[model samples]
Target: MQINREQLFRASCLSLLVTSLSFGIRAGILNKLGVDFQLDKAQLGSITATAFWGFPLAVVFGGFIVDVIGMKRLLVLAFLFHLAGILLTIFAQGFWTLYISTLLVGLANGTVEAACNPLVTSLYTDNKTTKLNHFHLWFPGGIVIGTLIVLLFNKIGLGWQVQVGVMLIPTLIYGYLFSRLDFPVTERVASGVSTGDMYKAILNPLFIFMFICMFGTAITELFTGQWIDVLLKNVTDNALLILTLDTGVMVIGRGFAKPVLKKISPQALLLISAILGAIGIYLLGTLTGNAVFFAAIIFGMGVCFFWPTMLGFVNTNMPETGALGLNLMGGAGMFAVSIYTMFMGSYYDRVVAEAHGNGAFAGQQILHTTLIIPCVLVVAFIGLNIYMKGRAKKSAAAVQV
Candidate 1:
């Protein structure tokens, strides 16, 4: 059957947009849920953590099986889970209900990444890195849209449920788009690579190293991103606006990745990003006044390419691992966020109590503590950059022989 790659790309981007919209709205509403449910920061963190745990579970499993069951079936499951999750969240009465519903949404979000990452790479084989960056632009794009919706709803005094319901619009759009599309065979299957080989590729020491790096990158970007609203609430009354500005910078930065990559190798990019991220996080933790916005801009630029660039590096350098590699990389990242979300929540709660319920001081302290995640990335990525460069020189020398 003939397929239109452009149409498929659009469908995939829309699917991701739905995923990002759901995430943005969920993050925006965390405070509301706490007040309504009489939950503490730790409880709210647990609720937020649930939103990420299901992602790694589904992506790792789905990544292994996506080729066998096909992308179409997986996307269908994602659509249904998204629909059900939204309905459940709207009617949720307490923590358990919200937790289960958020898990379903996370599963849906994971499935979308599992299917679409491979799909996008397959469609744009010649320009995987550049196209992947373009594809992920919608993440921040959707966040911008979601943030605007929340602000609009807030202005009209609409409840959080209504903000969540707004996700349904894109949800239904992507479902229809996906249902009408045809999926291509994954690059691994199309190349006749054995399933055993795919699994073995993941065990390589280099893959393991990259996987560890992915965890740090994920925590640096998503852990801070998920909690941005709450952490910055005391920093500025215009927290959502700040969130919007942060993502807005990401949108622009990602759009320019192709140009940026022409000058810097992916490993070098990761190394530089880790350094910038560490600096930004430290500034965010310790600095105040108007400098918070400056710090956010630095952090945004640092994270703009972290997720997609990491995936692109793996895919480009380790094409033998295929979808499983991408899935595991993505899953590891999400799982890191899940673990840190709970930890940060608990840590914030403890610090707030010690500071006599001074959320501002507690937030600053928490950010200070969180700076360690990015600082570790700085050292790790430096080693990775040096190692990757050595590997590249050897491969180039071998090719010349």
Candidate 2:
């Protein structure tokens, strides 16, 4: 089939936007839900992290389904899950219901990502990394969109439940577009690759490095994206207003990554991203006044490309692995977040408990705790950068021979 690159790209972006919707809801709307349910930090994290929990399962299974059933079917299922979860969440009375709803939401998200990541690569096989970054720009972009929605609703005195339910509009529209569109063939399909070859490729040192990078990248990016609202609310004077500001800065950073990835190698870009993220997260935890805002912009810049860039790398080097590789990386990343979220969730409650409403300092400590994730990200990038550089040299040398 002839591939219309533009149409496929648009579809990929929309898929990413929809998949990221659950994260937006968790990040921007979850805390308010915490108040609604009278829940604690632990429950908040559990319900919020439920969507990501599907990652491990989805990563292993989502790719197989994508390979067997196709992207179109997987995407349709994802949209259904997203729509159902959002509607269920609207009327959820207590912690258990919300938890189950979020888990369903997570399943939809996992399926969407499983379907779309390989679709983007198949669309622009010539420029896998660049296209992948362009594809993933929507995730942060969705956060910006979702943040604006939340801010607009708050300004108008709308209920959080209505704001949550309003996501149904885009959910339906994107699903419709996905239904009409014919998805491109997978890299594995196009190459006519065998499963044994793909699985063996997964064991390659470079492949393993990319896999681990996904885990660290997920932890770094999701940790901030998921918790920043609460982190900002705790430290800043105008809590709700800061979400817009932070997400806005994050959007700008993500949008710029397309150009930035072109100018610098992904490895270099990642290292720079790590340094910026580390500084930004650390400052967010420790600093005050206008400084915190500046730090947030820096941190957003740090993480802006971590996920997309890493995916780009995997797709470039291991195109034959197809949706399985993408999902494996994505699932690994989310699994890292699930682990970190649980820790941070418990840790956040502990810090809040210690302070007992005393003020900004308590918030500062929680914000500081977030630094651990970014710090780990910095190290993760350093390791991945070294491996990528070595691999690049090996590829170039092989070509020379």
Candidate 3:
């Protein structure tokens, strides 16, 4: 069977677009769900948590079995889950329905990533990092599209249900595109890497170390994004624009990632990103009104290299771990985001109670505390940068000997 790599890649991007659009749709609809369903803050958070938590369940499971099940079957699952999730959410009557719908969307999202990440690595073996960056730009790209959809809907007096229903368009498009193409064997499989070797590679002390780092990196990016609409609403009328502008910056930065990699090592990029992240978060918390846009740009740039570069570094550095390792990294990140989603919700409610229901104060207070995560990451990345460089030198020296 002949594979049209470009068509497959486009399908993969649209699949991811559906995943990110879910994020945008949920962000835009949180308040609507809260009011229409008569749910409390914690319940809404729990519902949101379902989406986050559902991702890891699919990603970890899908990652483990993707090779055996075949990428095409996994994508078929994504399309079906996506279709069901969108339709169910459109008809959701209460908390349970909304919760289940979000979970389905999340599962679909994870399945898409599970299938596509390995697929891209397989398709572009020579330049995995640069291409991964290209592939991941769709994440922000999709969010931008989703956000616009939300805003456009908001302007026309359409409600959240219709906002969600719009996701079906791209979902169907990708489904059709994928149905027509032939999937290549995963890069790990094609390279003749044994399953045993792939399993062994994940337990490598370095893989474990990076796995821990994945928690910090993923939380820094995903948690902020998940909560952005809530966190900034009180501070800026342009609250949505903060997310829009930041993601727009991310789109531009990721589009040009190839040149960026030529100048900086991934480790160095991670360290720099951590520093920018800390500054960006703090600035967003402290500043108000239009000044928030500046913080948004800095935050966007900070996170630009985070998702792709982390996956690229591990995949390139730890080739033996194969698709399983990539999925684990992705799963770990999503898992962390899920945990924080719950935590942030509880924390917000507590702060509001303590402050006598001051959401603005609660918002700023949480941002202050969240700033610590990225601050700690700054130090962690410095050490990581040093270690990776030294390790590279040792590998070169060993080859010479």
Say which candidate scores most in lDDT: 3
| Candidate with the larger lDDT of 1 and 3 | 3
* Best first by TM-score, ranked: 3, 1, 2
Worst 10 residues of 1 by lDDT: 237-246
lDDT-based ranking: 3, 1, 2
TM-scores, each model vs. reference: 0.98, 0.93, 0.98
lDDT per residue (tens digit) for residues 138-189 in model 1: 9988887888888889899999999999888888998998888778899889
Lowest summed lDDT window (length 10), candidate 3: 236-245
lDDT value, candidate 3, whole model: 0.89
What C-alpha lDDT values do all the predictions have?
0.88, 0.76, 0.89
For candidate 1, the per-residue lDDT at 269 reads 88
Clash counts for all predictions: 0, 1, 0
Query: Model 2 residue 22 lDDT?
Result: 57
Q: For each candidate, C-alpha RMSD in Å?
A: 1.1, 2.1, 0.9
